[model samples]
Target: MSSSAEDPNKQPTLYDSSSSTSQPLLSKLNTEEPTIRPDPPDPDPEPTQFLQISYNHGPRPFKDLPFLILFALFVLSTFAFGIFLIFNRNPNHGNVSSYTYDTNSSSCVDDSLNLSLLLSSNNWVLFNNELSSSDFLEYLIWTLVVTLILSVPFCFLVLLLLKHYTKQIVYVSLPFFVLFPIFFDVYWFVACTVSSSCGDSFPLLYRILVLVFVFLIIGVVVWIFVANWHRIELTVNIIGVASYALSRNLGLFVVLPLLALGLVFYYAPIVVFLVFARLNGKIVPKESDGEYSCVWRQDSWVPFYYALGILTMLWSYTAMVEAQAYVISGTIAQWYFSKEDSRPRLSIRSTLRNAFGPSAGTICFSGLLVCAVRLVRAAVDSAAEEVPGFVNFALRCCVNALLASVDFLNKFTINFAAITGEAYCSSARMTYELLKRNLLSAVFVETVSTRLLAGIIFVLSTIYAIAVFAILKGVAKLGVDSYFVAALAWVLLILVLGFFVNVLDNVIDTVYVCYAIDRDRGEVCKAEVHEVYVHLPISRSHRSSIVPRPLGV
Candidate 1:
């Protein structure tokens, strides 16, 4: 057996034994070590620990410390200024003055009345003598210093509040509420101090102070607008809600249904007026005496164009006003009417309280009434010479002024009516009552329906008047006895042209309103459901793969 197994030629071939032994050696070598020298130990990863020095770290804390110190200084300065103002001794010791420190001066009391009546009655000189006698310059400086000091704390507080709340309503409104009163007070002090001391000769310091405060006011306004950018969207939404509510509450009774009626009755008549104006053309040119022929041309259609423009403006105003009124009415109702009751309550007592309190509404109303009266008087006086029939002209002008006043009053009154009506009735009952009573009130109905009508009438009358004057002149040149029929024709043609222009305007306005509604609503939709996608770019460190792969497979 040994002989056979050990036989070199007869035993297993060297090729077969060698292959088996080599396989085991290869397997051991592959298992024990990598062939590529293990990437030279990765260079110990280059010592990644680093010192990050940030300038912002120490500087941030230090920066805030100065602001805090400045703020504290400002508060102390304000306290000092207040004490100075309260206790400053009057230099003129012998003058027993009747000047009462009245903080409760009625702001709503007519300024003109106070100037004309109280100042004259009390024998108070337009310029108080005491103001010039004292250290007025010092007081002015003190005023400015006080303002600056107060503003620092105020600005700091505003910044803190804005940071804490992070709401647009507070951010926008708070600054205005804070700044307006401060600036108003500063202005009051400056004006009173200046008028009392220097009369018309305002000091350079006063002017500088005014300019600085103006700039500050502007900055505050800009900041408010910027901070409350998001609130603009809210405002627009509020406007839309208001408009819809108005349509639902007021339109069904007063405006829309009446508008429908006007469209049915007056619209046709207006269209006819336009058509007549279009058909009867006026003289484009007329010749005068030979040597220098006078070229007489008439813009018979110009009145129509003016009319149309006016109508468009009026309609736009009415729409905006109505929407605003709805908003006011709803807000008032929610705030004053609906609380702690099954039905809405008027709370006349609260209303009276607000009227008497320091609010803008009473001031605005009184101011507006006074201005309107002044305007009417001025208009009447101005038109006295130009009008052919003075009394009739005055009456017409008065009527126009009265109509405008009514429109102004209507804005507030309609809101009042809606509130009061809602208070008296249940929501269901109120809705029905508002629809019924508001519709029947002819003045309200007609006013809402015919916002554009007055414009149309005024344009036609103006055009007719111009055309008649032109024809009278032309006839006088031709010969004063030239037929009246021709002059009448010219006037008719002018009126017709005015009507056409008005109609064209109405059509354009209708189209614009439709487009605006679509655009506004479309914006609302886009804002509501718009999708935004965010993408983060890959950094260099993140680009490396976790596992290594063979270069060429």
Candidate 2:
């Protein structure tokens, strides 16, 4: 029988026939099977592009060495100069030269007491006075020693506290500790200068102590610089960003809005006060008393100049922000364009579009809206003259309340957006969330409730001012001729009361906020986990064992 026609069993099934074919169809079909062929070689993954960011690491190793040497020479030169100045000068320069005689005296008599009588009668008083100088010097020296001794234990205690709460302490306290030397140097220089000017000698022991302090300060500075290199860079970057923003969008977003707001909330009130004074035939207060003076007036020009300088600084800061923005944008653009995959290119465009496109317009629009509101309020206040005191007071209160609310809202929105990395378009919504989140935690509400607390503070301040006015008016009715006395009393009372109140509020707020965020939530939204690359401490043996390899030649 022929192979193809002999038996029915010899006729292949469809699958078998296809498998036996020269094309090997079954293998092709199996390629699609889940269990079968290898994953198409994974197409060599695109290389991950790295970002190159350059920054000033720290002062050059020996940049300050020359300064240090110069400073040392200056100190020595000053010390020598001071000694020469002291020794060469006449001691009698400070002494009473002569007693002046009045021509109108009825008689001139030889009234000189006997030397022995003068010595004996006031001898104890003279001796006590002489010893008082020595006693003061001894006391001063003892006090200094005691202060230094106390500081040592205090410093040690602070160090222990820092170590115990390193995570919390590092952000705020460590910087202060690192910068303490700089502060100490300033204090020392001032002290030395004052002493040298007053004919006090710089002791050898003090000089040695200062030299040791200098070296220790240098070491501490170096350690801090090394430890916070990345942080320093980040701070620079942030400053740059702010500067760039300020420069590019100055009048449109920052200056105009701020000026407009100030005109409405701050200057307008001063103007109202001035108008009230003029109408009531009272003398308008000076700039020092918070009255607005026109720029053209000579007396007011100094304050105007000061304001101009501040405005100039703001402009300069804006320019810096613009520069930083440009730099960052250029860097991001370059990075995106240089990527191997198209995905990153798309992402970069999207990011830019989101950051600098429609969102910017929205921000500007919001600023304009705020400016318009401020302008309207100013216009209304300016136009009104016969407004009732209660109405005016209510209006002022409303304005202040609004400003406080807005400021709080601004802060809350910024913090919330930063924490979430999510842009919230609605300010009202953001404010609500902020209020809700804070209220949820009793501690948070107690501490950091700026808007509510500020409102309360304003009310209390108004009440205090009224009380002060009443007291001063009552005192004036008591036949006092001096306005200075009344003013002094008023100022002293406010200062003493305000300082304590502010301190108490700040302490409570700070403690509560810290507890709320750190202890209550267990999520530190304000702080981010930063990955730092530090050189692992390697033993000399391990380092030595790492042999150098030859070139591929």
Worst 10 residues of 2 by lDDT: 528-537
- The alpha-carbon deviation from the true structure for residue 433 of candidate 2, after best TM-score superposition, in angstroms, is 21
Task: Summarize candidate 2's per-residue lDDT along 1-553 as a digit string, tens digits.
Answer: 6655545557644355434455555776787788855656325321211111121112212222332343334334434433443344332221111212223552222333346554566998888778776633444344345434443343334334422442343345335443545665666656665676422576656655775788686686567556655554333222222222222222222322343354346334333333222222112212436433211112232344334333333332332232222223322322222323332234223433432332333222233334444555665576455575777778867876776565445433322222222333543364343333333322223332222223233333334444444654564442322333333433443343343233223322222223223322333322211111011112233223222122121
Q: Tell me the spans in candidate 2 whose CA falls farther than 4 Å from its real position.
A: 1-210, 224-327, 330-357, 361-553
Pairs clashing within candidate 1: 277-496, 277-497, 304-498
In candidate 1 the C-alpha lDDT for residue 480 amounts to 30
Tens-place lDDT digits, model 1, residues 289-324: 522221223235535533553343333333333333
Residue 504, candidate 1: how far off, in angstroms? 35
Instruction: State TM-scores per candidate.
Output: 0.21, 0.22
lDDT for 325 in candidate 1 is 36
List the global CA lDDT of all models: 0.36, 0.36
The top-ranked prediction according to TM-score is: 2
